[model samples]
Target: MVYDLAIIGGGPSGITAGIYAARQKMKTVLIAKSFGGQMAHKTVDIENYPGFDKISGLDLIEKFENQLKGKNVEILSEELHAIVKENDSFKISFEDGKFINATAVIIAAGAKPRKLDVEGESEFLGRGVSYCTTCDGPLYQGKDIVIAGGGNAGFESAIFMQNYANKVYILEYGPEARADEENQKRANENGKIELIVSADIKKIQGSAFMEKVVYADRVTGEEKEIKAQGVFVQIGYSPASHIVEHLADLNQRKEIIVNHDTMETRTPGLYAAGDITDGFLKQVVVAAADGAKASMSAYKYLQSKNG
Candidate 1:
């Protein structure tokens, strides 16, 4: 059967789009390999979502899933392979060899955090290595922790983690930190945070859990290690727009390009939202708003085509 709309993610944007589509009385199917994307897995505290002063990422994801159950959206847990446009409709193929047709599509597949790929990084996952400081910062209360990267994300996380970690070490591989001057000043002023420049991360070493982070001095060419209980990676993110790359236009960052006002891409009947799209801000609330706009735009496009 041809669905009226097919949403290609289960994150906040996709879930919100599904609800909005259901309200428009559209035959919608939401397909995602996993539910809740990064928000569910990485975010620990969500205080700026407007509805609740604070909520765990997993808890908010649960509420979104619960609300979706009462809607007319069909949920599919499958990995997408490719999307091919045929005539005026879209044929979405899955890695499992199954396929489905839809009149319009909304690609909300979000991005994933970039990894450091150092040794022990994978083995020590959940034990001491983490990608989201917000999720694992509290675990290292009164302990020392090392954060990799010197960009806005790294410095910002370092400042935020100061509340939990006794000492926050910010390591940068470059000659100097790349964060804004303001962030640099704040981090330097904070007694708990130590900004280390020209430090190249080598590996994470520990016996039971992560015990130390090894790095090399880029300027002096000397190796060193920092005793810490946890290592937080705050490099950046890579958008998950590979599946629909052939069907949509992508920017240099591999983010889907869409009209911000309507969340519609260059291709008619095709929309993208959330971190997958080229939006300035990557937040849960912003993603929800994108989803709402994409669904409404899809509904209007369908109405025009059918009439």
Candidate 2:
């Protein structure tokens, strides 16, 4: 059956949209590869989300999913391949050669962490190198680990790792950290965290997993090696928008360009929200707000078409 609205992700943005759309009695279907998106693997405790002093990333997403359990929103575990407009409707294609037609579409695929692209980085993924500290930090309890980056994500991971790891080294390529002052203060207070600035990771060495990090000082061009069992890379993130690249307009960073008010893209029936849209801060609260705006715009668009 054709759905009234097809949400293209299952993260906070899409799930929140599904909740809103379904509550409106609109036929909504949530198509996603997974349930939680990036929040699934975070090992840190999140206090930013409302109504909770502290909660695990996965647990919060699970609560979101549980809220929609009995709703009309149909949750499908499918990988969206491409989207195309046809007449007044939209057609969504899946990787398994399946198709779904909808009157409106909300694209909320979210983003993935940027890779270091250094030697042994790819091979050591999960084995010793991880992108989400909340997911893999506990595995390295009382072990030495290296965090590559000095941004908010890096500092957050460092603070989280202090709970489990014996020592945490933050290897940043810049002279100073880019993390928020509050987060930086907290990281500094944690005696276990060692901040190494202006250093670039040259190589991640190990046989089966990551065992050491070869770093080079950007200023003096001096080389230094640190022995560690695991490495958490939190340099930055790239939006997951390649599939819809041809269908929408993107900004300089390749993020979807949308009007802030309506969340409408270049296409009328198409809307984008969350980190996939061009923005500086990628936060869960902002994503939820975007989803609400997109849903309202979508509802208005549907009303105009029906009227």
Candidate 3:
């Protein structure tokens, strides 16, 4: 069946888009391989989002789901393979060879964590190297671990590791940590966490699991290795825009470029939102707002076409 709107992604932005589009009485369908995106995987408590003083990522996602209780949005749990514009409608193909058609499409697929391309990193993915601290922090209880970033994500992971890891070292490639003042201060004050700047990661070495990290001190030209049981790579993220890259314009970072006001991409009938888009802020609230705007913009676009 051809839907009026096909929303790809089940994150905050995609959920919000589905909610708004369904409310407008459009035949909407939200498709995703997984729901909630990175925001749902965050172990830190969310305080910046309006309304609740503090909430967990999973709890926040539950709330977003609650908003979709009565909306006429069909949820599809399928991995997207490709999206092709067929004349006037979009043909969305799934990995299983199933396909669907839609008049307008909203791409809110969000992003995935960036990986450290150092040696032994891939070999010890589950055994030691991890992208999500909350998921793997417990495995290193009473052990030493090195965090591969000094950004807000890196700082937050370091602070969280204080609860389980015996010693946490934050290695940053830059001259200083890039986290905000508050997070930076918290990480510094945490007795268990040590923030190391100008440290370039060179390799991860271990026999069965990760045992230590090798790096070079940029300032002193000294190669150093830190003994650790685990390594948390909290560098950052990369947009999941490969499925639609051919259909939209992307910036240097590979993030989809969209009109700020309408969330519309250069391709007509194709809108983008959330971390997948080149938005200045990568917050949950901003993504939700973008979703709302994209849906409304699509409604207007469809109206113009109908006229």
Local distance difference test, each candidate: 0.91, 0.89, 0.92
| Winner of 2 and 3 under TM-score | 3
Q: How high is the lDDT of residue 174 in model 3?
A: 97
Which pairs clash inside model 1?
A: none
Q: Candidate 3 on 1-307: residue-level lDDT in tens?
A: 8898999999999999999998899889999888888877778789999999999888999899889867789999888899999999999998779899999999999999998898999998998899998888888899999999999999888898898999999999999889999998887785888889999999999998888999999999999999999999988899999999889999999999999999999889999999999999999999999999999999998889889
What is the alpha-carbon lDDT of model 1 when measured against the actual structure?
0.91
Over 282-302, each residue of candidate 1 has an lDDT whose tens digit, in order, gives 989999999999999999999
Tens-place lDDT per residue, model 2, 234-274, is 99889988867877899888899999899999888899989
Per-candidate total of colliding backbone pairs: 0, 4, 0
Q: Which one wins on TM-score?
A: 3
lDDT of 1 at 11: 96
Q: Rank the candidates by TM-score, best first.
A: 3, 2, 1
TM-score of each: 0.81, 0.94, 0.98
User: What ranges in model 2 sit over 4 Å off?
Assistant: none
TM-score of 1: 0.81
